[model samples]
Target: MANAIWHQWVGCEYRVLKTAKENIVSQRSASPVLSSYARLQRFILTALLCWTVFTPGAVQASEELHYALTVNVNFGQDLGQPLGSLFEVRDSQGEVVLGAGFASVYNTMLQGNRHELQLYLHGDRDEALEISSLPRPSPAMGTFITAYNGELLANAMNYGSPMVWDSASTTWREDTTAPRYYQTPVASGNLVFRPSQVEYQGRTIFASERTTALFFYGAGNLFAWEEGESDLSKAKVHAVPWTPDRDRADMDHAATLELATSSAFPYCYGVLDNEVLMVSNLGWLYGFDGEQWRLIQDNSGNVFQMYTMLNVYDRLLLGNFPTGGIYAWDGNTLEFVSAPLDYAHSGMFEAQTFALYGGDLYVGMWPWGELWRYSVLDNEWNLAARLFSHPERDSDLLTPYRSLLRTEFPSREYSSHSLGQRVYSLLPLSGSLYASTSARSGRDGRDIFHFLSQQELDQYGAVHRITAPTEASAQIRWTGEPTTFVLEVHSDSLRILQDGVE
Candidate 1:
């Protein structure tokens, strides 16, 4: 019966007997019904094998996806915190495809506490990748962060450490070849880099902070460090002093003395065509000509106290703090542009907004991230967008966000450090936006959060959960595309997958 069943399964192959002996052997071994069943089985197996050989699987290749990385700084009781805890996404060749960090914060903290954040990129496959922290510097103050020109390589500053990202070895090496003159110890206080430029001695210069004073370092010279190193050592540091200077060479000496004597030291400074334009906190505008400084305008005697200034198209656009009023500097005179809303105070601590894009002026207001587009032809301010924290708002500020930093959208404003878990800085990289939060959360320990693209958030949800600990770490991935993708959040891992596969 078993032989009959096998032959029946075999089907047509059993009918074409090659020899009488074979047929006789089959007859002796199997019943007719069994042979027929065996033949059928064999025929079915052959057809299935042929069909499988010709047909392909149904699944298709997944779409390429991008992720924005958000890192949260969690300080523990032990001062021995790690430095340069970088969260980087690399390609199969181990080349850094995207990277970001709070450069200003890391550099500021590296001198006092042994806390550091180091993120290294590893792995070449699509499998589970491990992200581990690097060792902390001994007696570390805190990790200070800085990014490459494009924010591709986010770096941490420790004393005597070099700054080099090795693409071949897939590592960051200390830049030992950097001229000794270029190497300066990280400043010892809270510092932020501004995009202002100054002109001195017929040369354009840029200033960055060292402690309290702004160091006027010349621009356009890659080897400017030779001059900076020499000048920095003998650099004459000035404060908004209130004491009258005995030396006449100090342009601000008298003003410093006055500020010292008086209760107010009202001064605002901005970069105007390679010149450091100083507006007294009391609203006086002066032009520093690199050697001697002279007063250009005294608005303290007028109606406005200049909080921020931007030189646009040979005209100066001045913003009054607390109040959302604006003024224009047109060569020979200052003209009032507009005033704040009725309910808004002109003196509230607000961030000044001046970003030049496509020949138009983009001005952002503090507290509320309201963006306005300034038209040069009509002399009008148009409501462009308002950055909001909520996802349901009608504002287009968070949609189709583009940045050079590839981390977070640059439109958002960060709250002060005292405001825990708030954002502090916004960086734009490779058409993506990146931001750093004030601190980690107390519950889930997530200190940072990334708002996914509007399209993705709408398709999924506003908050795409990554592997950020509810308490300590914040993770964000930039989906470089403008389409929808999946954010897979698990306790042990987080991945941004396209079409449900990673």
Candidate 2:
């Protein structure tokens, strides 16, 4: 009876006895033939349904994710006002972020030498993340010096003590014993230390106070202390005294050069092409072959103090202090290209500074607190922006006359402040501008500011929040009947079925 019922269901319009015999034969050939066939059909149907519902587009919508970040600059020192702010991000979004409020951590009127502040970024629903802190130093410690090595930012307190801030970790650690510190003193008393010249031949050669002899520090060598002193000394001066390969010995012999003066007191030295150029405070230019330092010129004759010098475009560019002017030195002569507005000297007062950005030179006259941009190509000058301004009158009383601007030519249009209350450095990071300012007195008064790009700032209705995706219901699914029946029925049969008269 069961076999008859199965045959009737399988072969509804065909020969029932023939179908029953075929089914019995298939059952004998394979175990549970009917049940397995039904199961496979159901699986295929379910798979088809799943494929239709979860297409590539649907899968992408579910897996998307976003990470948010907010950067804060706290002034650890004594600054009159907040310098600026910037938003930095490390995520898949690949865009610069911005903060919502201007959080003030110090009151300048109180005149407190020590102040501490924290920069906070509000995430979704006012959830705050403290990005960094600014700590005020003791009065005796003086100002701090910071250095940026592409990925890591390092600062030295009181000249030799080093501290490193990791952008990835958003934390600060003391690096007082960093390996880069050689016996070379970068600063002394009131004088700032500048590298007059640097020579690299598998080692670094720099001129410092201690030795008239050329000092060589090997590549990848850490800072080591001398036998009995609290300070370190030069590791190696002459070429590798001994080498296993005779070829390397010959190469070193050919590569070595002798300096003209046993005393390395020259204020400026740099390499150009295969030749090296050195400039002295008394206005002399010296060139060095692989053999000796030959005198190039007795005097530069330009009426400016050489504060910074660079070899650019096969020409030697010199930055002058007191009179903020730029001079170009060809192999034979020095010519003045342009000067800052009012011929303002960087040494005139505190807070006066300048930097090179995008092949143009920028000068900041402090107390006046105005920014001037010099176009090297056009040989013209324009006011880029006003950082701080005092009324034309009474500028003397309020101006510090000792502002500092330390940066290489900036490729991007953003800026940042250092430890001083003024903008210490202005540069771009990840499509946004960061400004860092320092206070004169405390560990907690340093402030870092961020400015976002125009496109990102425009996206927000009020420039405080970001747009996020909302969840929604699943899309509808469709099922279809077999196509064999459609082919069997004609247009008239289909119309009859539609009319409900089948």
Candidate 3:
């Protein structure tokens, strides 16, 4: 048998109800929050995913069926996580693959930076391979890195300019020998390269200048320069105004837009049908063709600032900022669907990014810096932290600027110390989902070091990884009456049931 891992979340009471050759059940007690946990244990953990990533190469030798594994868990009432002890999951060589219990209620790293959420599929391959694409926004991933055309590409956050990871060595080589991607009238500061550019027709598109303007990357820059825009880099394949390719572009058929709103930044972009839908922070939706632009919906004054755009479920789902909800756009009509960011007393936030994995939609939430999973099979949204280890914020979690960051990070809405939090980017790399974050507060800016503290900085940037806890640390005290927990594995898939109720 191949080595396997199982993550059992917090639940009530325990006992081994059945044990047989075909069916084996394991029981453990649930513990309370760590001794230092401040939430008072009001919120117990719900569901967790099971894995199918192990022994992918060994299974399906006949291309029909070869193996199946099932593990069941039962818990007693009032199970708690009060051990307040730190532990690790180590490999045979003694390297810790996972560590948690840094002042947590569940002692699980559910509140940390990254997690490899299990996809329960019993097959010869990993299910993460099914995820095709995801938004790679620059905000969440302070130094977000991506891959394109088989080469590793990274942003300009650490390096002054865009960088490419040397497949040969540990060093990163500058993509453009020039110091920058753009040569401005003076200087364009530092441009965070959003590698996820959407391609339409022959034009590949991304936004810059605060997304107030859209830049097209193509063979020729067939557009007239917007008066204030800058020029492109030395490798001028990207078609934009004021670039070398401008000479090859037709001045008459220039790609220019006459948007309905005044100076609105395109914070969100989604591909619906064949049209690229651009939604501004102020709720103005527009559809763009190679030559023509059409205003889709004008919610300009409605204050429905949408931050994230996802083309999923045959529709464009816009993450509304103020309402902390989602707006569904089916090309013909656009309306509010549901508020899945059901965090503490909510006011305004940025539902920043979205990714699809294991037949579910996962959202990168902001101001609280959390990730939520929406299950299509259950028709419900569940707070599933597929990655990270921070203490769950209290229900009344709010900040100074209406609990939101300044519209601009350097904006003078609040002091420079509190820039707010974000799950920033839910990027799909290789065959798995990788995430990055924009923490609520930290030493982000070089000069603003004095504004932050060591405690805040410590919480900001630790890379956390979690695995199934060892049996020694699995036992806990009681918290409630007995419920149910079940794990069923077949030759094709794995299924889990919590609260012992199936």
lDDT of candidates 1 onward, in order: 0.28, 0.27, 0.37
* Stronger candidate by lDDT (2 vs 3): 3
TM-score of every prediction relative to native: 0.34, 0.37, 0.50
Give the per-residue lDDT of model 2 (tens digit) for 1-502. Answer: 0000000001111110111222332333232222222121111111000001100011111111111111212222211121121211111232111111111111111000011111111112221212222332122112222223222223322333444555456555666444232122111100111232332222333333433322221111111111112233322122222121111222233233233233323444333433445554445566554354466656545533443444333455555544556666666667876665544553432322333222234444333434455543335567655433222323333332222222321432222122222333332221112223332332321111123233321111100111111111111111121111000001111000101111
Q: Which ten residues in a row are the worst by lDDT in model 2?
A: 1-10
- In terms of TM-score, the best-performing candidate is 3
Ranking by TM-score: 3, 2, 1
After superposing candidate 1 on the true structure, give the runs of residues whose Cα lies further than 4 Å from its correct spot: 1-147, 152-211, 216-268, 271-275, 280-284, 296-307, 330-332, 339-351, 375-385, 390-502
Task: Give the poorly placed runs of model 3, Cα more than 4 Å off.
Answer: 1-141, 156-251, 260-262, 289-291, 343-345, 386-392, 400-417, 439-455, 458-502
**Model 2 residue 411 CA deviation in Å:** 46
Backbone Cα, N, C clashes tallied per candidate: 104, 61, 35
Runs in model 2 lying further than 4 Å from the true structure: 1-149, 157-160, 168-171, 176-264, 297-304, 345-359, 363-371, 375-379, 383-502
Query: Alpha carbon lDDT of residue 286, candidate 2?
Result: 61
